[model samples]
Target: MAHAFDGKVAAITGAASGIGLATTEALIAAGARVVLVDRDSKALDAVCARLGANAIPLVIDLLDPASCNTLLDGILSKAGQLDIFHANAGTYIGGDLSETTPETIDRMLNLNVNAVMKNVYTVMPHMIERGTGDIIVTSSVAGHSAIPWEPVYSASKWAMTCFVQTMRRQLNKKGIRVGSVSPGPVISALLADWPEENLRKAKESGSLIEPKEVADGIMFMLSRPRNVTIRDMVILPSNFDI
Candidate 1:
């Protein structure tokens, strides 16, 4: 009669808002103690308050590798084990090929690529030591199918997708389940700042997807038995032909 996630510890990045926050909520509902990670203290505090003491907040600027190590150490020290590692934090900036700044592109890669690697390195040791765990990386549809002007974002996601897939092959033998969730066009903070008319047009054109829908897909993947490893999953709106 034990819940699937009972007694397990989940470490999630970007737990302050958007898809990351939603994923944290989903895991908690399934009975896992969570380490809520984000750069924003106030937002993290608000999320932790709502989730109760079972949730611990660790503020980390994903751009800094040392900070990542410290946060991971704290989680493993406090929780003793890391049952689930969710690399679910990312950023985006949209502009034409000529309009994008070098700074914007660099920022996107730093957040989406380097920080993801930090999470992997942080939790991998514990998983390897225990010989069992689940690792889920939040990739994007852009990983598989590139957009017209989203070069850095596409490259970063593709890197994540590839890393997780390769990891599945390498880590499976170690009794670790590694997978990735590639969500397409989710209507979340990912693009909340865009002009309403532009956003509406994309939705009206049938390209927009939902955060909860994606979160549900993640929960489904995580709910599977230990022997079941979903190498990669791509969730696109019905409108996406491919």
Candidate 2:
């Protein structure tokens, strides 16, 4: 059967593992050509080899702002046009605000916040020129509410949530859609890094969602009609309290 995204081109950041990797698989299955962007060249190459020809792995450090433009150029150079840009690359800083060093804080902000903005900026003009594009970000439920244990991570997601909402309003008339998938407690590298106790509790309770589930939500958002934009979809496990 034919899929809705047949022949579409997508670029996803942090595609080496977790939600990003799951989303890459989902897009490729839907018949879209995907550019899998991640800093881990070895893992990325292995994944691309597994995913086959539909997947193109581009290893670049998103923390370097210039890499954003480089990523855009690479996508255009390879695919000629980009239809979807999933700015789903993010890091989690788990702990009290005081426990985080300035360097750690900077790195988290750069990857989770600054890099997102730069990627959108690099791709927006191209999408605007074409008068069609979709930008889906992977935010967190913590962005919609306070998470005392993850103050820095929450702040970074909140920034992303706001950016997605604002950009939707700014670009809707240009035929571009901006939205986010805010998931709670997915079984990804980020969640695996949580304090051992919390990870164990969530796992024991089956309170963590899978990366593939979040990717499904992203595919639904992308498959929507051009006039229909899912501004935000908050996905959570049924047993999740927050």
Candidate 3:
């Protein structure tokens, strides 16, 4: 009856909803104690209550450098050690580049790029010192290609995709596994603001995936034996065209 993640501790950002929340549930089901990190206190509370005692809700904004410090400190203080870190917190801004405001650009880059870098930076030492850990970043299909519709978003994900790839090699000798899951489109808040026509088309064509499906991909990567590292996985809806 033993599970692959039994006795392990995981901290996931953006855990209040979407892929993050689904991953938390999957981890907990696999016997891992999870710390749900998100910026929404009320949503975090509701999710934790629904998830029961195994889920610990921690509301910390990933955009703030100090919050990253607080998150790591709080995780250690509460869970003692972190065996997995899912740097899945991110924001998306979709549209023509010319129409995007400078402030919006800054916000997207800060949350999608800077925040991810800071979280990994804050957690790497701990994982390295312990000589054991897994880091899975939620990237996007956009990262692997130049998406004209989401130029800035694609740039952010491209940065993460490269970062994860480089870190995997850099940390391999240190015993930490680094990887990324690039999903095409999922039924989550990330798509809530998508252009109506595009959203409708995706829905009608059944080209959107579920959060749990992406969670399953994450678990597959994490469940691999220590000697086996699934470096990168691009998961997309079977019927997705782009």
Candidate 4:
């Protein structure tokens, strides 16, 4: 039986854990060779080993402009052909913006917005040359709504929302599909700052989802027929509100 991703090559950033790792496992299960890109060498190596030969790990800090620019090129050289690119690497900064320092603001914006934009720009021509590819960026529910608690984080996602939608139109005729997976709070390290009581309450109230749920949403987006594009899929837990 042939799989949708058979013979395809995918490179996912922040692939060492959480949503990235879940998606990588999903893709590999579907027969795609995956390049796991992250800055943590130890975690990357562990995941690569656990996932076996199909999981290729590449360690690079997306925060650096030079590293971000060469991400796709490095993948192509290793994987030989790039068919899928998931820009899942990002950081979070919630709570009062007043307490957020300039450095913190810069880091969040750089990882969440700058790195994603640059990598997509870098990979476009290659995907264009092939005339086929899928570009999915991991966004947040905050991207579509004005979440006051995480104003700065929300702002970054809003930028991603605009970027993904506009890129979809721009690449429509070029045979490349651009989309975003916007997921509500999932159980991940990103929630480290959340108070333990709040986390417990959210989980008990069915307001939190697992990382695999988001990965499933991504799989749905990628598995759709090429002619059909799922521009944005907002995945949230059943009881999630506001």
Please provide, for model 1 over 70-120, each residue's C-alpha lDDT reduced to its tens digit, 9 standing for 90 to 100: 866878776777888889989987657577788887788888988888778
Model 3: residues with Cα > 4 Å off, grouped in runs: none
- How high is each candidate's TM-score? 0.93, 0.98, 0.97, 0.98
Error of 4 at 124 (Å): 0.9
lDDT score for candidate 4 against the true structure? 0.93
Worst 10 residues of 2 by lDDT: 63-72
lDDT for each candidate structure? 0.83, 0.92, 0.92, 0.93
Query: Model 4, which residues run further than 4 Å from truth?
Result: none
Residues 1-242 of candidate 3 have per-residue lDDT tens digits of: 23878899999999999999999999998889999999899999999999898899888987777776688898888788999999998888899999799999999999888888888888999999999999999999999999998999999999998999999999999999999999999998989769989999999998999999999999999998899999889999999877
Q: Write the per-residue lDDT of candidate 4 for residues 1-242, one digit (tens) a residue.
A: 13878999999999999999999999999999999999999999999999999899888899987777778778978899899999999999888999789999999999999999998998899999999999999999999999988998999999999999999999989999999999999999999978788889998999999999999999999999999999999999989997
lDDT tens per residue, model 2, 1-242: 14868979999999999999999999988889999999899998899999999899888898876666698889888788999999999999989989889999999999999999899999999999999999999999999999998999999999998999999999999999999999999988887568899899988998999999999999889998899999999999999997
Residue clash pairs of candidate 2: none
Using lDDT as the measure, the top candidate is 4
* 2 versus 4: better lDDT goes to: 4
For model 4, state the Cα shift of residue 125 in Å.
0.8
